[model samples]
Target: MDRPALGDLEAFLAIVSHRSFRKAADELGLSPSSLSHMMRALEKRMGVRLINRTTRSVAPTEAGERLAARLGPALSGLDQALETVDAWRGGPSGTLRINTNEHAARRLLKEIVPTFLSRYPDMALDLVSDGRFIDIVADGFDAGIRLRESVPQDMIAVPFGGTTRFLAIASPSYLERRGVPKVPDDLLGHDCIRLRLPSGKLYRWEFEKHGEEVAIDVPGALMLDHIGLMAEAAAGGLGIAYVHELVAAPFLASGALVAVLSDWCPEIDGLCLFYPGHRHVPAGLKAFIELLREHDRRGKLG
Candidate 1:
């Protein structure tokens, strides 16, 4: 007979989205046991079982599903309304959640994040570094950062970080012992640090020269998932590595690694911040985009 608290409803939505009390608790900054008690209280207040919980799993009950289906859009509208009010107060103020790959995260930390946080004292940022592509809207992220080519067709993309390239690199010792690879075919005779994609497929080393494109199933005894790790292994003389130029930069500068097949690597379109075109852009996200554009203008001017 009493109205449920807004916080309680929001907590319920977080639980359903993650399908785990522990994860939802982490998101809400509450202990798992506390979250469990809150859910029990909510269920009692509503006079119905909302969540079906077992020792191994937790899921929403039928009633909970219907509630969530309705609550999702309602809460989103409420959030937008609140954000609209906040935007009128002057500068953007609130958390901006972004999903990005490791490389992009690193770049932001070095080139953008410090400036962003310093410039907007009222704003907070929640950055999730992930290798796999995800649905930003479903994941509740304001935006996502990935290579321009990888941005979804339906999303609006704002490019940054300039052009990037992948390089084939090896330690001088390794090249001296195994002979430098002259072409993509020559990689078959060398020990290489191969990459394992997030989808469980081994990434084929790709190269371009003039208009010719080459993809090689490079031979390797060492397989790594991280570009930095692959570059480190190559620098340690374990094997040749195919990695982003940024990943190999330090080693190359220090003379620990020498680039092979340099002519094959060509600059490509760079990283982009992408978001759903249909949704109203959050004030914090708009501020971030404006900053990115300012940086681009400065880069062009200099």
Candidate 2:
């Protein structure tokens, strides 16, 4: 059998990984039609049908799947080997992809990303906002930001932020009308603003005081997925909202939202930058980690 072109193999792998011709084409800096032409040419050269395409989806043929399984690791190793030179000469120069929640995107990364990009001009960072727990390796992400408790045990983890507390907040008018909760259970009697997790279940508000912890499943007039939206709802007097103190800072300062049940709010382990433990850490990832740790250290000092 004739050897397939390296470019052809790369395009095929990208298409198979994404299951979309358009996405693979975009990644390769080619038009969809161009990618289609390349695939046809590749198929002609190999004399085999490598992919099956429908209007809605694309999938690899059995031969293509087997080929991809073998090619994936080999190509990955080649990429790493190539990057080693860049690391030796350039210090760190590659794209870094991360999956994180909106909260971290807004509260944590927002402040640092610009500086990071300016300082490391060769480093390309892609921050993908996702609320669900994802396997970073499977999804082609370099790392992910999640709360410490939620990070997988087998993964290598680094602290992204200091211990943070949740705050129950509401507008002055809402608190006055609904009566402020003196305790965690008092939320049951008030019009609460609840959070809905990505798994489609309501979030239980957690509180800790005097070494005792409480989880409250309070009824709410509104349920939201984004923390920013929840803060907005509470500011609009929808109900009492459970929010991170970092997210509630501006609203509380503006007097649009007032913190309640502060005594019950627990200072919990904050976000972690986690990645698969088994793989070799990319130089790009090491630079990112160093920046994160520097930011964390500066925050502690300041």
Candidate 3:
């Protein structure tokens, strides 16, 4: 049997990784029809049915799965080998894809992205904001940014920014109307803006003081998924919103929101950039890490 072209193999891997021809096409800069034709051609050449295609979804067949498993590592090795040549280029020049949550994405854009891009003009940063936790390696991402507590144990985590806290905030008018909650339990009587996690479950409001931890299933009519939206809703007097301090900062400064449970909401670990330890770190990613550390150090000093 003849071997498939390198590009065809890469396209197959991309399709398997995304499980969507359209998404793979977007990533590979090819049309979905073209990718489908290419895959069909690849299958014919290999004399195997590699993918199971349906109207709603696409998945690899058993043979395709085995092929993908082996091909994934081999492609990674090839990528690393090619990346070795980047050292001679005198600087990192490839794109670094980071899957991150919205809060971290905003922070990076505000403090780090501009400098990073300016310093490495040849490099590109692909920052994808997603609330749900995902396998970065399987998703073909170079790294991920999430809170330290959320980082996978197997991955190496580099903490950045600084320690951050969640604040239960409400508009002054709403607090005055509904009365302030002096303690976490007091939230039972007050209207609360609940957070809906990516897993389609409500996030129990967590608090700690003097080593005593409390989790509250606070009463609320409204539930929002995004932290920034929660803050805005609180500012609009919808109810109390528990959100990262960074998300609530502008509202706090403008006096649109006030922290109510400051004592209970102590600072925890900050955001971290995490990646798989088994693979060779890309030069662009290594450079970004260095820049991130430098920025964090300066932030701490300032």
Estimate the TM-score of every prediction: 0.81, 0.79, 0.84
lDDT of each: 0.88, 0.86, 0.90
Worst 10 residues of 2 by lDDT: 106-115
Pairs of colliding residues, candidate 1: none
Model number with the top TM-score = 3
Best by lDDT: 3
How accurate locally is residue 166 in candidate 3, as Cα lDDT from 0 to 100? Answer: 93
Residues 1-302, model 2: lDDT tens digits:
77878998999998998888987887778999999999999988888999999999899999889988988888879878887787457567878889998888875556678767887788899999977888676567889998899999999999867888789999999988878889899988888888899999999988899999899999977888888899999999999999988889999999999999988987888988999876668878887888888988888411
State the displacement of the C-alpha of residue 170, model 3, in Å, after optimal TM-score superposition: 2.4
How much is the lDDT of residue 253 in candidate 1? 98
Candidate 1, number of clashes: 0
**The 10-residue segment with the lowest total lDDT in model 3:** 293-302
Q: How big is the RMSD of model 1?
A: 3.4
Per-residue lDDT tens digits for candidate 3, residues 1-302, read: 99899999999999998899997888788999999999999999999999999999999999999999999889889978887877687678878999998878877888689988998888999999977788887677889999899999999999887788999999999988989999999999988889898889999999999999999998999988888899999999999999988889999999999999799999899889999997768889999999999987787411
Candidate 3: residue 86 Cα off by (Å) = 1.8
> Candidate 3, residue 11: CA error in Å?
2.0
